[model samples]
Target: MLIIPAENAVNWKRPPWVTLGLIMTCLLVFLFYQGGDSRLLDRAVEQYLDDGLLELEAPVYEDYLSREIRLQGRSDRVYDLQAFQQAREGGEPFWLAVSLLSDPEFYQYMTDNRDLLLAPAQRADWLARRVPIQEELIGRLSAFRFGLVPARLDVYTLVTYQFLHGGWGHIIGNLLFLFLLGYTVEKALGPGRFLLAYLVCGVLSGLVYTGFSLGSQVPLVGASGSISGLMGMYVAIYGLRKIRFFYFIGFYFNYFRAPALALLPVWLGKEIYDYWFAGATGIAYMAHAGGLLAGAGLVWLLGKSWFQVRESFFEPDESALDDRFTTGYAQAMGSLERMEFELARHQFEALRQHYPGRLIVLEHLYQLARLRPDLPRFRELARELMAEAANHHQPERMVAVWQEYLAEGESFTPLEAEDHNRVLFASLRHNDLKAAEKAFERLRQLGNDVLTSEACRLLASEFDKRQMSGRARYYQQLMQA
Candidate 1:
């Protein structure tokens, strides 16, 4: 089963150039470092194979068996090197010997054999023994020097490790996730902060992996940890938003929409569950979890901190425009408070120019029209608002606007029979006698079915409360007829 995000639920103001640049860098590094499919993992696995040499230069299998048998509790069962070597060739002996090696217990062993197992010199020696595959020695030879190995970690490998990939599939999968999640995160944090956070998260992930894989000699390479950080940031920023994800289980596929934060626990839980249950599948789940935590922490700090941030790195900047718009909006509100009708009207007009199709601006203008009672803009704003509400399927909003327009002692706009009857019944419910009576007259003119026996009965009660006994009796007699 796989779940993939299609796009973000919320739209941001800027493009994701920083994310794009990161993807390009990862691709370039992959092509440059392992373009020939250097078979580096193949060579690493080969070193673990038994070569039938008990006493010889670099007896890799025998050295492994002696150390394993001595470290494992089965040391009493093995009497000599030959016996241990023979058992090492069998499946049962191999698993029993390597069990501790896969765990943290093997850390001391790897530390003691650092010169033979973890050093670049040993890797170079191994490569030298093989027939040169390429004339240019530029590829797998660099993984050991740059990749992060918990057993032999150099300070520089923390950042360098993220730029390397074990294979094309590894790099491609990481890049896909990076592009999907990083774009939104970069836009949220802006470019400069995004880059810094990414590198920091990657470093944190490497540290977490080092803590977990203490004795492991295999070099961890890939941008998954950093990309996981982006996923974390994406969740933090859009946590409350209802985002859509495409999910597939075998041949069945469907889409799910849920709060963006909902997936965070699901993802983190999966990683933790896999770490305990799935064993190692060449994946650094601890590193992924660490990066996710680090990214969320950094985002929280950045959002809540008092530090002044630099300008965002996206082009066609809108920050200044947004500030100006906010200031202008405040001024418009202040003008209304001061009863500067013409001034407020002018400000609302200016706002409408910038915020065309914005209902709030139109609403303010509609209020100005009602207060002035002479401006033709009131009718114009009313017509626009009603149409806008109708198009948006906001029937309640439409009723509200119509009622407000009628309260201004304006004629109701020509509406369909259903809408007219709805407004009439709503006005009656609110005890807006004047609006309801006007709506009723309009309904009568349209010859709608609104004047049924039930309607007449309800209107009679409302009329009797208002002391309109003659109108009440008129409706009552009509109901009888």
Candidate 2:
């Protein structure tokens, strides 16, 4: 009794959700262009700041001091305070412009405080202090109904404000996160939705920051606030999904996977720790907090039900059977090719027994049965296979298999001249004259013309070898006839 291993048994199939998830992830990666050292924003900023011609405001000049700055070299003046006020009362872009222009001494003060503004924390605090100006700007813009005149809104601070940042580290850090998280959210929401989410998040984060900070003059830029919203959505939707993360502690490199939900606490904890202990790092803990909350709230309100439906579709089915017979057949063929006859026999037998109506298995079983001619069980199997084959289209293969076994079992050629003729020729070729003579007599009794001629030729050769000239000549004349 042979026992096949359990591992060899047919198993369950992979769920379709696995394939769908892989395709979604791949599309996200392609759209985002993830996995690289990203510095496009930095280069853009550098280009805008480096031009030698513009007499930029002192604060703007000081904010970019010692950094690679590239400027577009375009400047305009606000002659109308009501227009500025009107612009402020308008949309986000207008409000952004009003905040910049509202404080005339803002530029001078920043230039004077350049050293203090070098740190991210100080810069964030400085921007935070300007909350009242930003609020007034927002109020004025609201009063104007977000600049109903398209031209007025187009030229406002909203267009340029997003371009500013606290420091180089702040810009680069935010960009990295944006590139990583933005792409995924973009794929889920589409380009239009992604852009909308980004703008809304930025505006919301700015509102929160401005509300909390009151009356300081500092410029804020970069995409952190918006990207934080994406992160929140990612955590909410893919909470149970595993994400591979890389981190380094001192000189040691570590890699691991954790549920997406688990990362939230870790990120929040780190921000809080850094806020109090790491002074003057210039990071915006409050902005990060505001962005996170805003992102989560927005996505929850608008997309929670959809996310739940998507999650339901993504769940893998564990109870499904693989049901792929071709794989098993391939395995059997591989065993057959390796000359693992016993294994092949067992596989073919199981296939025949379990899938009796399958003609292909019956054919394979017939071939295997022919190999074991000495076994009575094989004879019965071969007869059954032949009977099955007769009912099918091609009976030749089954007939050939049966002949091979029959030939192996019985050798009655000695009594049948026509059948024994081949034996006579073979014996003669090997110089077995006695065996040849016995075969020739059988051919003579049969009176088969072709065999008789062949037998006479052999007899003449034998007579000549024995020096019987008369008998050789007589047989030679018969061969001539």
Clashing pairs in 1: none
Runs with alpha carbons beyond 4 Å of true place in candidate 1: 4-14, 36-140, 306-481
Candidate 2 lDDT over 32-151, as tens digits, reads: 432111233232223323431112333353343313122522121223333444544564342333344434334445646756644665555445444333344322332122211212
* Cα misplacement distance, residue 247 of candidate 2 (Å): 2.4
Tens digits of per-residue lDDT, candidate 1, 364-413, equal 88777877545566667776776777666665676788777666736533
Off by over 4 Å in 2: 1-160, 165-171, 305-481
RMSD of 1: 16.3
Each prediction's TM-score versus the true structure: 0.50, 0.35
Model 1 per-residue lDDT at 126:
37
TM-score of model 2 vs. true structure: 0.35
Error of 2 at 8 (Å): 32
